[model samples]
Target: MKRISLCLLLTSFVITPFVQASNTESASLDHAQVTYVQATQSQNGSWCFNTQVHHNDQGWKHYADAWQVLDLQGNVLGERKLLHPHDNEQPFTRSLCNVQIKPDLQKVVIRAKCNDHGWGDKTVTVNLLSETGKGFKVTRNNK
Candidate 1:
């Protein structure tokens, strides 16, 4: 009985820190952040954006749920909803295709949100003119 009790105590001591670290790591996912955004114009003049999002993603309960393209006025031009948690794929890049950018519009912002944390405060802006210049160019914004 004494040996069994001592073994259990030792095991718990070794496991407790790991468990606590895991919980801390998981809890950090409460806020989802958009790390980067790359915008490119297609041959048809439509715009497509690949956005990199970083989140803790503790399963479906908490994750970077979606990303959106908005005009300067905060009008949502396009949105990409993440179907599931990317727990194994931290800082993943997802693309929003076939986005129509009006000829008059020069810039757009990309924003990210999490299931539990809502929209992140940081946003990335892409300049349409510079991106769709003489030839197709990749405009990257690191936020």
Candidate 2:
């Protein structure tokens, strides 16, 4: 009986960390998040951006529903709505094309929202001048 009890206690100690780690990983994904964003300008002067959103899309009930591009002033320039849950496709990239951006605007931000959790606090910013002049540089926003 003593050996059995010790074995059980050791097993729990070995397994508890794994269980907690799994739960933490799942909880992090449960919230809608923008992992990455890439912006590019087309020949016609319009802009296109690809945003990567990570979410624990369980179903219609919980999913990353949309992402948007906004100027510094918070004016929405373009939005891409996710029609369905990306349950299997965690951290997926979606693209918005032909976005009309003013030439005078220097920067833009990207954000995503989930059906259950509202908008995520994180955002990504792109420098239009660098993207247009030299090459595109993707910047991550933790806030």
Candidate 3:
């Protein structure tokens, strides 16, 4: 009975730290994801982008810090920087306006970045020509 009790206690001591470490690593892997985007073109030919991001923000230590609007060739056309962590807001929308986009370009990519993860793999593409795409909406105003 003494040997069994000692073995059980030893096993817990060995396993507890590993379990805690695994949980922490997995939590850090939760990258910020761009869930939606809305792009609008004004009469002056500049663009405006409203991007929505989803992240498991762990306060100021880890959160969705910024998002970017990029052309097809990965050139940054616009960026919106988040000043603070949105702990209570699971998914949030922010906008960047007066972004100059080339007339020949027909699409733009939206990507989200977290303070812990840098940039996420998930991205949303906005079609400026057809004004349609998955997870995105586009509008053009000539007036």
Q: Which candidate wins on lDDT?
A: 3
TM-score of each: 0.71, 0.72, 0.78
- Candidate 3: segments with Cα more than 4 A from true spot: 1-29
Model 2, residue pairs in steric clash = none
lDDT of 3 by residue, 83-142 (tens): 999889878899999999988998889999999879887789888986778999899986
Instruction: State the lDDT at 79 in candidate 1.
Output: 98
Clashes of each: 0, 0, 0
lDDT of 3 at 120: 83
lDDT of each: 0.81, 0.81, 0.87
Window of ten residues with lowest summed lDDT in model 2: 133-142
Report model 1's TM-score to 2 decimal places: 0.71
Pairs of residues clashing in candidate 3 = none
